[model samples]
Target chain A: MDKLLRDKKAIVIFVAPAFLLFTFVLFIPICQSVYYSFCNYDALTKPEFIGLGNYKQLFTIDRTMKIAFKNSMFFLIFSVVTQLIAGLILAALLTNIKKGRDFFKNVYYLPCVLSSAALGLLWMFIFTPKLGINQVLAQFGIKGPLWLMDTKGYIILPMWVIASVSLWQYVGQSMMLYMAQISGISSSLYEASYIDGCTKAKAFRYITLPLIRPMVATAMSLNAIGSLKFFDLIFNMTEGGPNHMTDVLATHLYQQGFKYFKYGYASAIGTVLLVLCLIVTFIINKFVKVDNYEM
Target chain B: MTDYIKADGWIDTFNGGEGAFSQQTYDGKIYAVPLNIAAACVFYNTEMFETAGITTMPTDWQGLLDACEKLQAAGYTPLTISAGTAWCLSMLAGYLCDSEGVDLAALDAGTASWLDSNVVNATNKMVEISKYFQETAAGDTNDVATANFYNEEAAMLIQGSWAIAQINGANPDFENKCGVFAFPGTDGRVIAKSDSLAMSATTKNPDAVIAFMKYFTDDTAQKYTAEVGGKIPVTTVEYDASKAPAQLAYVMDVFGSAKSTFGFYNESMASTEAGSTFDDAMVAIYLGTPVEEGLQTVEDFYKNNVWNK
Candidate 1:
């Protein structure tokens, strides 16, 4: 086995297939998107290089990019913080529950397992004014504002609504991860804290809290990235409508690429999204690097 | 060869597979057939009509409101709309305006505006419809609207002919209870949409598909579309008034004598926001935003943010 691992031919054979596949897929698309970023290729026309013009429009000329970026930032910061707390609380609750704990865990994780489209459809029905909660609210003499259709962007209603949806769909997943991380902490730490005359709350704060910090950071980072790239749910629920209140980077890119057929502009938006995600993930990974140092 | 297929939304007449053409031998004349279709007219329960005390399907503006009022009095919603998934509501809005002889095609191309008198009238009509739609039924979607009609709950549902197949395919039985009519406005003109067949350049069976198109466009096939398919024919094949929906027979005549047949509503126009994005304004309209604002939204979006920006 050692000799085979050291063999040059064996190495070549093993790496060749993966290398070819990567070159065909990963490298080509990145290269193509980069190349397309500077050109005007509308799928119908031959490409024409315009030299940073697409980026120029994305940064300065396009109003949508700014709105998308702003909305993304709001959700990224708000959802990560809010859902982390909500997930941890739920995880703690599940940990303490003496009855049907496994069943409750499965039920909590079910929404996260559903496709974004299915979640969005459910969200639509839940928030739709006439047939949904609003109708129920009417029985109590209340008329809720049209959640998805509201265009009065003064309050950022659409962003908050979409963020809440993302939270509902992803909090379960974060809860499960936090639960696992909490379980991994030795029970003896809690016992020691309690035996030393600390209360349950203090034991939880001193033991379970610090132990799951890495997991909380990881889950938050993952969910933040998820919101930044959120496309399908927003697309189906509102199609970025009511005067583009809920338009995001992904839907904007799709609109430019497929609907408007502005391929170069779309590529630039994609590159920006990729770079943003990478930068964000890198920053978050630094805080969680304590685990890597031990390994 | 003309490139289109049923999968692309033409009638499933012949060669209804991936290919575009079908064979035909009509009167010893051999030619390539074409796939084409149009929007349909619909009518609801006349009992609801009578409860509204509407004696006839309204032919003009006055009769239209009288019908609506009567339908309301009879405890049924008058209009059937499904604007969320489909742009039939927009089509109806456009149709009402076009019946007055406004050139909506030009308007769609940005040569006109919602500020135009005809457009304003259409907007007013929509506003009226929204306001008059029983508050209970105003915001409900199309399927519910159809269910309400079929279950004898509502008086009418204004939908395209393709919906006939869907209604017939359902568990609820209408069975000669529902009827259809031309949407009345503009003093007798009809607003309609047509679907067509065009062959792709990439197909290997172009000749065979063309042969299929020929068969599909023949008189016999045209009749199949008219009678069985619940769609009117592109060619001048006459329908037997005695056999089919009386409104359809008259529709065939009206289709023949139509001053103009608008292509599928703005949403069906390729590369336009009228379908995917701009057309989504229906939700906004239901939420109490004005129609002119909706039109202005698309127009401003086209001007400020789209290509050439």
Candidate 2:
């Protein structure tokens, strides 16, 4: 293996298939999207060069695009914060427990096994106006706001509902990741900290946190990207209604491309989303500073 | 279609009849066969109406609201609308537009504004009728709204003749208890559309495809469509009216006596983008967006996307 790796041609031959697959699957589509974003095409007519016309309209004129951008940012912030915090807490609890740790972990992981479509339908039922949360609230003399249909709560509540549902479904994966990272920490560190007049909280803050910085970076990047591309749940639920209130960039792109057949405009939205995700990941890595501490 | 003409596989079977096939003909060459002709109107449960002591279907918009109020007061959910599906809500708004005499063609031609009095009045009328919809109407899917009517929780559904098969599939006995009426209008016009099948121009086996198309227009298929499917037949074949479902007969009567006819708003529009904008505008009206603002959204979309093109 070392001899083969020493030869540059042999190395290229070994990696060529995967590299070609990646280029065809990811690079080609992204290049096509970038090209389409600059043209005015509707899939039926020949594409005409418009020179940033789609982007200008999307940023300056489209009200739904503004709403979608705002909503996507909200989901990104909340999903990253909630999932990371909840995962850490659950991982800590699982590690400190005396028994039934695997059972609890498996139970938390069950939702991740289900498809997002099934989870979306389940959450839709739970948020249904008459029969789900509202029904429970009625018995306590409290009228719940129309969970999915409430327009007044548009800016905050609906996005949070979606964020929390995503959190519920994927937090287990985060927890397991944290658990794996935490388990790798030596028992001697906690013992030394205890002898140095430190409590469990202090040990967690100074020892456990620094050691797991790399894992935190990984989790944040994954969750941020996932939240940015969120679609199916929102699509099956309100479909960006009560009149585009819950609209996100992904759903808006879908409507523009599939429903309206505005391929150029939709590609513009997709390009913006791709750039936004890359910027977000870069910012998160800078904030986390994954290389600051040793493993 | 030109390719099929070149290949000698295309046929002009209808000979310029004024129904579905003729609607699709271009320069005296037919390219498709229509499966059924359906209309958008009101479908009500007979048992619910009898219990509510309603004797006659309304003939105008105001009278329809009066009937809805009575049904609501009679301990029944008055209507079930699928606001979750934008087009379902737009169907009622489209009929209301007809009653108010808003010419969509003129609007498309840029001679009319969507914020005109008639168009605004039509939007307001949809808001008026929305009060009688089920409490969960805005959240209900098409399937759920249909279920609400089938479960006897709602007295009426503002849907098309296509719903008859769905109702029967839900409860086979509903075929006998269901009744149909024309959508109320200012002068009594109704909206109509055809569900048709189009053939590909380049085909490997034209004979088999032609046979399938022929089966759809034959006597047995036409009668079966009228009798079992509760749809209007486009063919000249005859079927027993008494043997046909009552709701189908009522729809036929409404279609025959309609003062005039217009195509469905979504279908007759110049582009799907314009149609979807109109649908979203109607949904906004239901969600408390001002009538003028909602209509203006569509007008702006039409100007920018359709007219500019």
Using all chains and alpha carbons, the TM-scores for the candidates as numbered come to: 0.81, 0.93
lDDT of 2 by residue, B1-309 (tens): 434433432243332244445556668776767777787878898899988888998887778888898898899998999887888998888888888888988988888888899999888889989999998887777888888887788999988887877888788877778888888754768777777777776788877886787788777988898888888888767888776777788898988887766777876677886787788788878977788888888888777766777
* Candidate 1 local lDDT, B1-309, one digit each (tens): 323333344434443332223232224432334444555565666566655656667777677777778777666677766554436566666666666555645655656654577766765677677655534343355675565566665667777766665565463357466666677775545555545555556789986866666676777877777776667666556656465444455455655665544544564433475454445554456556787776565555555544334
Best by the TM-score measure = 2
Kept native contacts, as fractions per model, are 0.23, 0.50
C-alpha lDDT values of all predictions = 0.68, 0.83
Off by over 4 Å in 2: A136-142, A154-156, A291-295, B1-18, B22-31, B240-243
**Best-matching candidate per lDDT:** 2
Model 1 agreement with the true structure over A1-295: per-residue lDDT tens digits = 9999989999999999999999998889988998899998887888899999889978875766887877777877877887888899999999989899999899888888888898887787787655688888999998777676556655467677888888877889899999998888777777778889999788778677777878877897888798788887888777665545678888889988888788888999988888888888888887655342110
